[model samples]
Target: MATLILAQKATSLAYGPLVYAHYLQDHESDLTVTVEWQDVPEITVGGDKTNVVLRIGDIQVVGAANAVHELAIMSGHASQYTDVADQLPHWLDFTRNELASGDFKQLGQTFETLNRHLTLRSFLAGYTPTEADFAVWGALRANKIFGGNMKSGGAKLGPHLVRWFTYLNGLPCVAEALKGHQRAVESTRNRVDQGNFDIPLKDGALGKVVTRFPPEPSGYLHIGHAKAALLNQYFAQKYDGQLILRFDDTNPSKEKMEFEQSIVEDLRLLGVAADRTTHTSDYFDQLYQYALQLIEDGLAYVDDTDNATMREERGAGIASRRRDETVAENQRRFEEMTRGTDYGLTCCLRAKMSVDNPNKAMRDPVVYRCNVKDPHHIHGYKWKVYPTYDFACPVVDSLEGVTHALRTNEYRDRNPQYEWFFDALKIRPVHIWDFSRLNFVYTLLSKRKLQQLVDEGLVNGWDDPRFPTVRGIRRRGLTIEALKQYILMQGASQNILLLEWDKLWALNKKVIDPVAPRHTAITEQNLCVVNVLDCPALPEARDVPKHKKNPAVGIKKLYTSNTLCLEAEDAAELAVDEEITLMDWGNMIVKRVQRDPATNIVTQVDLALHLDGDVKKTKKKLTWLSMLTPAEEPGLVQCMLVDYDHLLTKKKLEEGDQWQDYVNPVTEFKTRALGDSNLHDLRQGDIIQLERRGYYICDRPSTTESPMVYLIRVPDGKAKSTAAKVNAPPNA
Candidate 1:
């Protein structure tokens, strides 16, 4: 067995070799590796100041980068890809010289170069990972500058770079290595108290507590479902227990395999992994037998009550006429229903828990219903009758060994009904824990309503930014870290408060603000031209940091010339001979202003350079872009900026109110703008700030076929203007 020795306190520099070794152990069955931690100051076997040492038989390697190279060669990974093997030393040299030298300008340039290189490739070299990838990834991971930029939601990193980094980090080998190191460090610290807000489960024990996230495969998961899934995973992991992902596919009319697969993918995106997976249909036979057992015990009966009358009777606390039916007759009716006979189509199996209980949910709820129309997505047309959620949940929960049933408080009234199943069937009882349902103002959590919106073309699709679905918000720039942080901050509060979207978005802002690269854009409509009286005769290109606060984000080129363009609104606000500061340049005095006599819109302005003027004394610090000559056309990239409003005009839609009536007539607003030439290089899903125009995410990049680049405005947690202001043409 090969042994790898690492420092007791391993730094990020040690992650590369550790991950590589773990990967080899997982993938190569014949290879056995053991890892040991030592309290040595440093390993100097190869004259390198590293804490990582790898020994194989009589040969030893020192330093993380060196160990990775040696291991790749020894493991035969290098010889397989001889083309990429030569590039390993180049990346190693770059890591040692450029990355380790602490040169911000060179670091920024290197990040941009690497980002462009990864645009079309999965790894640094070839199709599979190589020593080049391991060395570069390790050095970047250990570098504080790269780590900080990534920590801020990768707002500073290019989209392709972020994607590549995320893919590597998500690998099981890499994740496990990092997590093991984190656990080792955390083990030395005192356990922090959760304070008074911690909700404890009855009879909960370490490794014994089992929680399940049961999502019906009727529609894509919304934010509400995300909360439930996360909370269940939280409790299960908190107690070192297991989490089971159970698909409650009881309603054949609505459930589909597509929805089931999407739910699974969404859960994975949310970092909620289940130890086991199951479906309610898995217990169909068992649940049917249990229902028959209840019938034999006189605890359930078959009812032929019409849907309307049954609902009215339940609301009025009235009993069904067949409540006194005999067990034999009920059994025969249930069998007929299972066979999908004519009379059976009208009948349903109802638990005899109660008929006139104050809690309506306990009023002999229907346990089994006939669904002869639509076949089950998975089971097919095997049976015409299917179990309802109320009946299948408790039965499956108990059968699956779920210790604590964590659900929303909306199901509190049904808690008693759920408990009655155990007593009626004489099965083991499971604890019921109810937390508050996540409710957002102006947001519809109902799958039916959201589906209606999609079907009616009220929005783009389920992933529309205006919609509150998990994919929707994510497309709108909500980071998984921000979403998880917000959900955890809410904790186990039972108070069902209607939350505003601002708070959640505010948290997202904090995650993206530090690293989001800054760019410039000016509205094309009513654009004002500015001619400098005394400026450079030729355009000069200067390199500047993309983010003023975060130099590690990289650099962008600024082209300066005598001609500049500003937003019409800014020009309209300026007066002749008034001194104003040009952002990123210097203060300038407005010498002349020209406007259209018809509409009083600023058309053109002339400014004289005032480099010695005090920029702080100017009231307006304006963002301006230099314009190219006639040969370069406009010298700016045309972009379309898209902003959205709430789908529903009303803050809270009440029961009995028509939601369609309150749909906002116009929810999307688009503005035409001219942006810096660098915007043309941006790919889809890149997040950037448009100087004075707030933040935007690239929905579509500019192409030769379509000259306009599409950008969607990202909402900050500030008070927004009304519909008029949002829809109005951009002046500011």
Candidate 2:
């Protein structure tokens, strides 16, 4: 049980702890908290405010989710809570310290601070709403004006902020805590009245949760794209809904049929099934009509403003010269654009929503633009103009009867402009749910930069093992189950993060370790031959389990003979007469030492079988392949092994840094190896473990020109030497 006492006048400051405490209480956790309001004092000692103090069985906490978080940690859900320091930079202090300064202009700057932070996040502190969220929303709820605006949805206060604000305010504890604050309830009255935006269901009607996964087929799908695709599938299945695969191929300049086909194939590999497939270009005529109607209603106009001048005017909030163009002029210019005329190519249709609008997205934004450069993949030269995402998304979503629209919050700002189309077109509005886009450290997912790499030959191609594209990583040996698990774990987290590749591959290792077939691959350079003095005169074959844990995988023959080969590194580690276990063949004592002194390379070794010695007692267990073949033995498979390092040296690419400067000079490593004969039958894309080495993917089976098999290195949660080391002599 806990006791919470806050200044009655500053109950708003107590929002987080009070709400969190109430939440645990309602969950029937062995948790009870009694909250009482008191008078706030001007001075707080040691930064502990008496107005918002919590006593959890004698442990006193001052602010944030301190009490609740400590309890969560104790309950074994440590990752569920985050540090309160992160919440300090939020709107809570802005409204208290800055807004209270009586400078109304400060609100804009405050919103900007919170807005930038929210650009890729749904919560204030972490993936889930922390105590910081509850506190901020609570304080905002107390300010009758902000609270009232927060509930209305798409508040000018900040769309991202409002999105999070409404969601948090709707939680059971939040709803219960704000009971006395009528404005908050009334403002958010529309939220519940309409329905939960997160889980949209038709009102007084029956229908599946129809959703869509829209991708602009400009480039191959990368690792970051998997989250969006997987989440859509997850929600659709959870609700027994239909997921539509829609190609937002509005930009003909970049769209291609090849890319479109590759996207479909990629999703198939990821195991994403769609109930229906669609192309935005299919609704070209409808979008054109919507644009005409908007122009006819004086809600849009044709702008001849050049790109540079238009950007300058927009930044300065100055109206474009054509803002007041006649509807006839707009219609004519629009027709000319459709015909691919010179005048049409220079002009674009812009929404006449506002010139001095506070929200920049609503400030007469571009709706239709001429794209006479490249033909649409599906429509050829039939249409010369294309509708921007801002205009096409809402219109198509409504026409297709989409119940929910899930997208990256990077587009959060343009949301108002999106819904405005539906309202103006008098169509049903689809619920918008934005999740943060995925990003990785030392990697760029931008298609333009990726294309630059291809053009400059910085990497092999789209499927370069170093690239993050689905094909690239698959080539690098990422299993489907691993990709699925990674996506599911990060589902709907609005926090935009630049994560390390370590955790991702760490999860991948868990999926592969138990089932991966174990095989042996010895390095070719400086390969050492061993003379087994007491070896069998006549070669004999013994079968060994492919995977020790699961014998059901079957077995392979371990050929034995008087002659054998061992890796130079293993041979170098042996001391004359030192006993070592020749794995699967009992112990052997090294008798003779052979080396090329100039390079310190071991040439050969003479070993006498130590059958009586305890195999466990040996320090090193070396894997050796017999050189003499059995009667029906097929020779070991020759293969090329490939590995990679981060393409960029910089951890995070900043705006000022030239990316080329950070390009890692050496990022790929290759070595020749001899694999077990079983590798000869394995097809491309098979993943296997090389004992004492690393996991590898078969990039190419033995072919006509390249008689040797090709394998790519797979990260198995182990640190590896850099690409530069591959150039050095073996074991240097």
- lDDT against the true structure, each candidate: 0.85, 0.77
lDDT of 1 by residue, 1-732 (tens): 678887755454477788888887777676776777665556566466668888999888777778888777677667878977676788777765776656777788888978998999999888888777777787788778888899878777798888888888888998888776677555432121121236888999999999999999998888888988989998999899999999999999999999999999999999999999999999999999998998999989999999999999999989999998999999999999999999999999999988788999999999999988898999899989898899899999999999999999999999999999988888889999888888987678889999999999999898898888888888887888888877877777777888888878887889888989999999888999999989976887778999999999899878888999999999999999899999988999999999999999989999999989998889999999998633454368998988888888788888899998888777788888999988888888788988988888898898889978999888878778223232444322
**Which pairs of residues collide in candidate 1?**
none
Best by TM-score: 2
* Every model's TM-score: 0.71, 0.72
Task: Report the lDDT tens digits of candidate 2 across residue range 312-430.
Answer: 89988999988887889888888998888988899999988788778888888899999877888888888888999888888888888778888889889888888888778899988
Question: Can you tell me which runs of candidate 2 are displaced by over 4 Å?
Answer: 1-208, 356-358, 719-732
Q: Which model scores highest in lDDT? A: 1
- Residue 281's lDDT within candidate 1 is 97
What value of lDDT does candidate 2 attain over all alpha carbons?
A: 0.77
